[model samples]
Target: MSRSDEEDDDEDFQAESNAEEVSAAYKLFTHGAAGPITLGHLRRVAKELREDVPDEVLKDMIIEANGGVKGQEKDVGGVSLEDFESVMKRAGLSFG
Candidate 1:
């Protein structure tokens, strides 16, 4: 309950919060987004988010996937939340 102890706890909390914020910043988009996410689909994605997606991050994932901004293409590996349930069913990751 000392002042130094409180200060240390505050520092730890701040560090954790900052780390979470930084991680969130790098997350360009999330799953269950209502449509496909390919390079060709960036415009739709922006619309779904109701804001402009980060140019750098969106461009990078699309380029990494070799997508051409098309709106209908989904990740074949089914890594997105939209397909995650099915994938978990196949992989048996589901607890239920």
Candidate 2:
């Protein structure tokens, strides 16, 4: 196969792997729920895991996960799966 074809195959594999990672992380945060993950949900999960993460830090995470857009930090309602995936990618974080 050509170099370009190999590159495409690699990209496809990477995409599938990323999707799986995001799905797992999202499920962990949402407890298998079918809605966007909220700050409360994150806090509860952290507490359950005994992570001791501060609320401020969690808020910042929510904002960042929401793309850190201008004028939206204060109104971040929740973190959708897509937003979570984007933030995880941007931060180089993985569930693996």
Candidate 3:
């Protein structure tokens, strides 16, 4: 079935938001010596974001964006640059 114009607009907005989030993620990584970002970093970035996204939501977004993993909490194995980018692209955020 074809999508309505409003649906299409929403999709476009989502895409834009994702890009902004990705940019923010990258900036965080760079700020931290251009290294991979840890879950801690993600939390900090999320909190720094313009929108006040809850910790639970951020955690869920991280898991979902990176694909489910076992024992991810306290893993401390920072996400690779590529993975970080991918997660931001898949999350609900905006750079503006």
Instruction: Give the candidate number with the greatest TM-score.
Output: 2
Candidate 2 lDDT tens digits, 1-96: 999999888888887887897898798888899647888898998999889999889878877777663244565577888888777777875433
Residue-wise C-alpha lDDT for candidate 3, range 1-96, written one tens digit per residue:
457988878878887777666766577655746655556666667666766777666667556645655344565345555666665445544322
Which is the winner by TM-score between candidate 1 and candidate 3?
3
The residue-level lDDT of candidate 3 at 40 comes to: 66
TM-scores across all candidates? 0.32, 0.72, 0.43
Clashing pairs in 2: none
| Residue 32 lDDT (model 3) | 46
| Candidate 3 least-lDDT 10 residues | 87-96
Worst 10 residues of 1 by lDDT: 75-84
| Ranked candidates (lDDT, high to low) | 2, 3, 1
Note the Cα lDDT for every prediction shown: 0.47, 0.79, 0.61
lDDT of 3: 0.61
Ranking by TM-score: 2, 3, 1
